[model samples]
Structure formats: C-alpha cells, structure tokens
Target: MKKKGNKPLLDMLQNIAEGLGETLSPFCEVVVHDLRNPKNAIHGIYNNLSGRHIGDPATELGLARIRDPEFPPRLSNYANTFPDGRKVKSTSIGIKDENGEYVAALCLNVDLTLFQSFQGAISQFTRIEDGRVHEDLERTPAERIHARIDEFAASRATTARSLNAADRKQLVQELKKEGLLEIRRGANIAATHMGVSRATVYGDAK
Candidate 1:
C-alpha cells in the first residue's frame, strides 16, 4: 500500500520535471551555444599555448595570465524570467581546468518580447490626469530628447496597423520638433526598446 502511494508521488514529481524541462529547452539551448562558443575560443588558445602547433611562447603565456578567482570550472547557466512573461535574460559560465586549477567566466545576453497589456498598465500608472508625462524627469536635455523620439516612434507603431509614407514622415518631424530624435543618436536601448531604427528615427526627424 505504501509503495503504491509513493509511486504516484514519484510519477507526479517526474511529470513536473518533464514539464519544466520542456518549457526551458529553448533558453537552455541558447545558453549552451553561448558557453560553447567561448569555450571553443579558449580551447583553441590553450592548444596553441601548449605548442600543439606553432606560436610564440611569450604570447601564449600572456594569454594564459588572465584570471579571476570567483568563478567555477564546470559550465553553469543562470536566467531570469520577467513577471510580465515578455523578457528572458541568461548568463552562461565557462569552466576550465588549468594546471590542477579550475576557472570560470561568464557571458550574458537578453531576449525580449513585448507585452502590450503590461506596457499599457505601466504607462497608465505613470500618467497623471489622463495625460502622459515624460518618465525621465531627471534626464539630461539630450537624453530627454532621445527618449521622446523613441517614445513617439513606439507610440505610432503600436497604434498604426499600416502607416503610409506621409504618415511616417509626419511622425518623424513631430518627434524631431519635440526633441526626441537627438536623444536616440547615441543609445541602442531606445532603438531596441521601441523596436525601431536609430536610422529611422534620425532620418524621419531630419
């Protein structure tokens, strides 16, 4: 009787594990690729260092001198799942064994998906009296300009099912006049977040 009860419990645990693994498979594959690329690079360097082929001894020794003590020797991955279900970012660690020593290093990347409902809710909360206010009240003049340009592009794209050339041009002019275009000139975050181009924002503004 006890064995029968435990069997069900074990089956439940296995099912849960399988479900979690299926959900995480894509992210895990990305993490594996990230780790593998750098590990291959390092291994190639090590092979050259060991005089497996032909290379300068001092150069190889110099490459070997880079070290950090806090990491580990086996590959490990860490990821964070956003509450909005729209973004996942992961870090991959590469482990190495060096002369009876273990060393590890990390590479990190972010994967983002937009959740319109979540964004709308947040934007709504930030608005005062049915009017939206700039989120970066403390930003520099240039930063504010860029932010506004990105915001305009994002707003236009989100609302328009199909924008004509004239409409796009108008949107660009409006963004530039509002000082949004200047801010985006130096930032990748604005482009990535808004899902538009630095070129589009700049060209339209111009």
Candidate 2:
C-alpha cells in the first residue's frame, strides 16, 4: 500500500489536541508542530498559556528529532520557562509514521505559578507552632475553666489578672457561650483567676 502524506495523522492529532486543551483548560498550553516543516512547524495552539501562535518555529527538541531520528520520542515533566519568566512543567511527544520517520510533535506546558502559590497557602495553613501547647483532658470542671482562661490570656500576651476591660468583657462573653459560667462556682473561679470581683464578671457577662 502506498503511504499517504502527514495530513491524516495531523488531523487525528489535532482532534486529540482539542480535547486535551478543553479538558485541561486555562492552566495548560497545547501546541501541535508539523515536523515536516521545521521553520513553520506550529500548525495550531490550544489553551495557549505560552503566548505562541500558528506558524511558529519548532522547538529545539523538535529540531533535534529532525536532526537525529534516534532521539527519544517522549520527554515528560521536563523543566521549561515562559517568556515572562514563570516556571513551566512540560511534556512533549513525537509522532512517527509507519516508516518510523518523525511526522509531528505534541507539546504540553503547564503553568506552575498558580500551583506554587496554592502550595504556599497550604503550607501556611497547615503549619504548626512550637511549644506552649496545652491539651485539655477535661480532668475536672474547674481545671477546664482555668485552662481555657489561661489559653485566652496567653493569646493576648497577658496574664488573666492583667486582662484589661475590653479583653475581660470579650473573654466573659466567650466563656458564657461555652457554658463555662454554668459550672458550680465558675463565676467565683473566674473572679479569683482574673483578680476581679464576682460583680465585675457578672457585669462583663451582661
């Protein structure tokens, strides 16, 4: 059977490229290169994140493939860069004919800036601070109340007794929400810990 030119294979790859471009969306760039014509290799571009267009020259890898057909057919997750200096993670695949001649190439370049920023946010969210840790086993009602008070004070960089009026009012409201004030002598306990009178705690709660 006499072989056809690169059209049929190019058409098939173009379909696959369109699907991948739509599926991967804005983060990925997909480029189709017609290897037969190195100078005007870019046949089409999809999800064009790299700022390239049709009729662009083939990449160095494509040129290498043409210069030496023995070159690797696929190189995946290779490091690359955009013209704006953003990082790129890329993959390229060379398509060959029945005669094993390089006919075309498909290149996928993924924008890593978004992922890198997301990774930073995740790292900050999941980070753990060192020391000054307290685990409330709820050993006793009074202990739970006092521990929570201590934690609240520690967060404000002050001792329970040193809490100002604003801090005290906020703490009293939060303590009431947790039903800490409902415990027996809880008001007395809070008054003693904070060096305040029962009347003051009650006023803060009101």
Candidate 3:
C-alpha cells in the first residue's frame, strides 16, 4: 500500500500530466498526421537520393539525409495551425526512453491569440494596410526578393539588366512588408518561384 504522504504527491503529478495532455491534444494530432504528409514526401525523395528507394538517379545527394532515419536529433519541431478562425503556433518534441531511444512524441500547441490581436492593433495604428511601407519579417527577405525579381524578369524574356539590384530589392521588400507573401496560392507558386520541390513547400507551408 502507498503511504498517505506519497499518495498526495502521486495524485498531484497525475493531475499535472493530465492537464498538460489535455492542453496539447489538438497539436499532437496535427504533428503526427497533418505535418507528416509533406514530411513523408520529403523522406521519399531523400530515400531516392540515397538509393534506398527507386527513383531517378539524377536526384542530388545533398538533400538525401533530410529523410534519413539516422538524421541528427532535433530539439523541437514547429508548425502553424489554423483552428477556430485563428492561427496558432505548434511545437512538438520527441519523447525518449531511458536508453535515449525515441518512444513517442509529445507536442505543445500554443494559440498566439494575444499576439495576433496585438499585431492587428499595431497594423491599424500604423495604417500599414494603407499606402505606407513596412519591413519584411523573413530573415532573407532581400534575397527572396532578388530571386523573385530574377524569375519575373526571366519569364518576361528579359534579364535583371532592366532593373538595378537596389530597385529589385526595394520591390521585394515592399511586397513583403505589405504581407503579400503570406497569401497562399497553392503549390504552383512555391514550385515556380522558389525552385523547391512541391512536397517541401506544401508540407512546410500547409
């Protein structure tokens, strides 16, 4: 039989665990099933690259390890979730056994409810939706812009010779600041503009 004092501690621990599990149920579902769609495709391509799966041999080996089971441990995983008319940020961690083998994964989904509201308020205050300019959130915003400009120039059967580097960068920066980049136009945009595999773009973006 358990001692009276120990019984209380056990009860408290159980309660805490249950509470945490309840809080994270939605996020866990998304990580395992929802996020895995793209992840699996990425793995398939990587496997093909390593000759573990049958596919075109022309596949580059650089990205082969992304799907490798032997890939290094990751501390956390991040994804975005849209639920109840709000967007939430989700994070998940791998649960490991005593011997350091992964047993299962535990996830935490946080609703950035307040932050989203705060952003809206700030946007209104600064009249960002108006003709005013804004800053880009992507770290490589300038590079991304340059890439987009190059693609646009090429599609028009022209080159960057028509637009200076500064001009192209400015256009990209302006587009980013206006939140135009966040709008999703499906897999085609990512594939055409970014030169990334459809799987990678859909998986991460979805």
Which candidate ranks first by lDDT, i.e. highest?
Answer: 2
Q: Deviation in angstroms for 151 in model 1?
A: 7.2
Query: Which tens-of-lDDT digit does each residue in 132-195 have in candidate 2?
Result: 6967654688888889899999999999999999999999999999999999999989889899
Per-residue lDDT for 85 in model 2? Answer: 98
Better of 1 and 3 by lDDT: 3
Off by more than 4 A, model 2? 1-4, 134-206
lDDT per residue (tens digit) for residues 1-206 in model 3? 22233334334433544566455543322221111122332111110111222122211222332244343344344545443555555544433334443323323445566767889999889863656787777736445544665776676566644544444445445444555456554344434454545564444443
C-alpha lDDT of candidate 2 relative to the true structure: 0.90
Residue 12's lDDT in candidate 2 = 86
What's the CA RMSD of model 2 in angstroms?
15.1
| Candidate 3 worst ten-residue window by lDDT | 41-50
The alpha-carbon root-mean-square deviation between model 1 and the true structure, to one decimal in Å, is 21.1
Instruction: Write down the lDDT that model 3 would get.
Output: 0.41
- Candidate RMSDs in Å, in order, are 21.1, 15.1, 23.1
* Clash-forming residue pairs, model 1: 73-95, 145-179, 145-180, 146-183, 146-184, 149-180
lDDT of 3 at 111: 55
